[model samples]
Target: MTQLPLLEQAILVLAALTLLASFSMLAQSRLTSAIHSFAWQGVMVAAATALVAAVGHAHHLYLSALLTFSLKGLLIPWMLHRLVRRLNMEREVENIAHPALVVLAGALLVILAYWIALPIERLELASTRNIIAISLAIVLLGLWLMIARRQVVTQVLGFMSMENGLFLAAVASTRGMPLVVELGIAFDVLVAAVLFGVFFFHIHESIESLDTGKLTRLTEEEPA
Candidate 1:
């Protein structure tokens, strides 16, 4: 830590924060709290991107960071908060089978991610190589959360977290992508969120519940 430059060290710290936020989201039971954790993770991603931009002298990354902060950190979260309020799901708790087992599985995934990234980490000539592994772990953990939790909103949170991990991995490994591509991705995420919000309404109206497990149990005799 002492030998590393200030910017590199800051980037590492922010990456760690992002990983911690991923874990927090996975562990959280309430929809509202998990959304908040996702927002904080976005903030960490933006900060890390900005720090990398400073280190690599990539001006476009600054814009990317701003976009990430606005879209993921603020806009999406605000939108989800409104959705929660409208759906009356603010206090809804996710039902996870064997919470401790889930956490242990997540830890094992981190080890697997580290092993998978070993070859790339060795060849990468950047200080952010280790972050790539962390990002992959985050991705897997988010997926695990989606599979283990039995709540619609929590699944959405997991999806968003997985996207975050992908973004982090790209930035760490490639020092950010083209601005046009980033803009497209940002727009796509916003559009997807809107569509998901609309689907939430229809799902709630038809089934009077947001639990996705119920979808599989629907019968022709029962009214949707």
Candidate 2:
């Protein structure tokens, strides 16, 4: 048995922390806490990208890390916090229908991710190949977060988190995306955040709530 290099070990630790942050977002009831968890997840992902850059000597990944830390880690979360403040939802607490069941489902998804990544792991394409499983698990957890949470803001958080997982997958599998592509993605994400803010204000003004369930009821009540 051979010991992994220190940098690789640190990357693995960051990967694990990113996965835990995903679970934290899933189980969080308070919207603010969930947002904080998502922010930390971004920070971990940026750190992992930086470590990968160092290990592979991919100078571009360092830029990607800085971009990730700025956009995902700082800008997006700040936008969300501002939106929450404006909406007066700072203290809003969402009730997960079945907390334990949702967490168990998330655990199953992690197992599924590992099973799915087994074939890819065998390829040994990169030193960071094993991180693929964790990346996939984060993606699955993000999807689960969207499905299990009813609040529109929570769904947006889940969506952003899913993007984080995809970004991590790229880092783990391909060592990072082209700089132009990452820039395009960052711009698109910023646009989406602004759009979501506008949408939230519109929805709140029209219906006085951000609950998707209420939106369904509203649609049902409207005359055809």
Q: What TM-score does structure 2 among the candidates reach?
A: 0.96
Candidate 1: segments with Cα more than 4 A from true spot = 219-224
In terms of TM-score, how similar is model 1 to the real structure? 0.94
lDDT of 1: 0.89
lDDT string for model 1 (1-224, tens) is: 34889889899999989988988887888889999999999999999999899999999999999999999999999999999999998888877777778788888999999999999888956878899999999899889888888787888888888989999998987999999999999999899889889989998998788988888874736555
The CA lDDT of each predicted structure is 0.89, 0.92
lDDT of 2 by residue, 25-115 (tens): 9899998999999999999999999999999999999999999999999999999999999899999999789899999999999999999
Identify the candidate with maximal TM-score. 2
lDDT of model 2 at residue 138?
90
